[model samples]
Target chain A: EPEVTQTPSHQVTQMGQEVILRCVPISNHLYFYWYRQILGQKVEFLVSFYNNEISEKSEIFDDQFSVERPDGSNFTLKIRSTKLEDSAMYFCASTSYRAGNSPLHFGNGTRLTVT
Target chain B: LAKTTQPISMDSYEGQEVNITCSHNNIATNDYITWYQQFPSQGPRFIIQGYKTKVTNEVASLFIPADRKSSTLSLPRVSLSDTAVYYCLVGDDNTNAGKSTFGDGTTLTVKP
Candidate 1:
């Protein structure tokens, strides 16, 4: 089965530094999403992208955060100034509208560690 | 979408059936109940999804009450590898509703 692919399985960056997490969604998928989970916490929705534009976003996706689909296949989430609390496991998901119903396929995840 | 209530943790033995129930008293008409499993250091994986009645798949079965206020996830003859955090999410299946929020998941430990 085709799967979502995320680069940099693990990243350690200093606070206030800019970081960009990349994901290559399934070729035919149309929707993209980003979520994060702090240690011992529930997974939180960050943003959703469709039609090459942001369709929805949560409070966590503030001015410091941004998402872009620079290429047809590449989706990215960039944090301009990371804070210590920004440390978490970030996941990328993509979904297809084909067949009967759509199911989101998720990547292994990018573990962002801010020091 | 509606918030859900579930036990924080559960313990089961290998080869035993594991059932995790989630209560959502305020489920909306457009909402669908979905269950996901997450192992440590990995992304969550979809287990089962249902709007009503009983939906069964190779990995698990989902039972939804007629009232649609609650749902149960049943795993038949689970193994140690089934140990993971299980999340019950209430959301719309609409193509545009992609960012479904996850509640505090129930941690299941399947021991040998």
Candidate 2:
């Protein structure tokens, strides 16, 4: 079975630095999403992408955060200036629309650590 | 999106059956109840989904009442490896916005 793939299983970056998390969604998936979970907190939605454009975003996805599908297969989330609170497990997910039902398939996740 | 209420945690023994119920009193006509499981350091995985009645898959079974206000996830013959956090989400198939809310899930610990 195909699976979503995220690069840099773990990352350590300094505060105020820019970080880009990369993900490769399933080949046939049409919708993609980025979600984050702070340590000991519930997973939070960051953004959703479809047709190479952002479909929805949450308050956490503020000015510093951006998502892009630079290539057909690669989806990325970039943070211009990281804050200490930005440290969390970032997950990439994708899904297919079949019979008007779609279930999210998530990658292992990228653990972002800001110091 | 409909809010869901479920137990915070549960403890079960290996080889026992585990049933976790989630209450969504405000479920809408377009809403579908879906469940996801997450282990530490990993993203949530799709388990089973159901709109109404009982839906069964290889891993678990989902039971929804005629009122559709609540649902249950039943895991049969659980093992230690079945320990994880399970989330119950209520959302619409048209918008897919319901998935955005990942409330605190019910943590299940299966001990030997």
Candidate 3:
């Protein structure tokens, strides 16, 4: 089966540094999403991208966070300034159909660690 | 999005059938109930989804009552490898907009 792939399975960064997480969604998938989970917390939605524009975002996705479909296959999330609380497991997902009926395929996840 | 409530944890033995129930008292007409499973350090994987009645897939079965206020996920002949956290989510699947709210999932531990 095709998979959603994320780069840098683990990343370590200092506070105040900029970090970019990259994801390659499955080809033919139209919708892409980014979600994060703080250790021992529920997975939280960050943003969803469709047609090269942000379709929806959460309060957790603030001014410092942005997502771009840099290419046909690559979706990226950039954080201008990493805070200690920013450390968490970031997941990328894609689906061929809307989330209601078709299921979203998720990547293994990129573990972001901020010091 | 309707709020979902599921158990915090469950314990089962290998070969046993496991059922995890979720409640969504305020489910909407367009809302669909979906379940996802997550292992230790991985992203959530879809298990099954249903709007009403019973829906069965190769991995699990979803049972929704007439009221659609609650649903159940049933895993048959479970094994130790089945241990994982299962999340129940209620949302409108027709729109590409808005994010689904995920609550703390039920952690299932299958023992030998």
Candidate 4:
């Protein structure tokens, strides 16, 4: 079974630094999404991407956060300035179909740790 | 999107059946109930999804009542390795619908 893959399984950064998390979605999937989970907290939606553009985003996806599909297979989440609260497990997901019958497939998350 | 209410934790002995129930009092007409399992340090894995009645796969079972306001995830004869956090999410599955949010999952521990 093909699965979503994320790079830099663990990252450590200082506050105020920029961080880019990378994800390679399933080759044939069309929709992409990014979600984060603070330690001991619920997983929160960050942004959803489709057709090289952002389809939907949450309040947490503010001015400092952006997502780009730089290439056919690469979807990246960039945080302009990392805050301590930004430290969490970031997960990438993709799906061939959008909703109803098919559920999004998730990748093993990238643990982001900011000081 | 509907807010789901599931247990905070559950424990069962190896080889025992475990049922985790989730309540979504305000589930939408088009909303579906989906369950995911997450091991520590990894992302949540889709276990099963269902709309009504019962649906079963090789790993688990999902039972949704007629009202669609609640669902139950049943893990039969669980083993120690089955220990993980289980999240029940209610939403439409498409980008056109909305982004899905996972609530604080129920941590399930299967002991020997």
Per-model C-alpha RMSD: 2.1, 1.5, 1.3, 1.5
Better structure of 1 and 2 per DockQ? 2
TM-score, one value per model: 0.94, 0.97, 0.96, 0.95
Off by over 4 Å in 1: A97-102, B94-96
Which of 1 and 4 is ahead in DockQ?
A: 4
Ignoring the other chain, what TM-score does chain B have in each prediction?
0.94, 0.96, 0.95, 0.94
Residue pairs with backbone atoms closer than 3 Å in model 4 (clashes): A99-B93
- lDDT of residue B21 for candidate 4: 98
Best by TM-score: 2
In candidate 3, stretches whose alpha carbon ends up further than 4 angstroms from where it belongs are B94-98
- Which tens-of-lDDT digit does each residue in A7-53 have in candidate 1? 99999999999999999999998889999989888888899888978
Q: Which one wins by TM-score: 1 or 2?
A: 2
Best by DockQ: 3
Give the per-residue lDDT digits (tens) of candidate 3, residues B2-94. 889999999999999999999999998998888999998899998898889999999999999999999999999999999999999888866
After superposing candidate 4 on the true structure, give the runs of residues whose Cα lies further than 4 Å from its correct spot.
Answer: B93-98
| Candidate 2 residue runs with Cα over 4 Å from true position | A98-101, B97-99
| Model 1 DockQ class | acceptable
Among incorrect, acceptable, medium and high, the docking class of model 3 is medium
Query: How well is each residue in B1-112 modelled by candidate 4, as lDDT tens digits?
Result: 6888999999999999999999999988878888999998898898999889999999999999999888999999999999999999887644232376678889999988
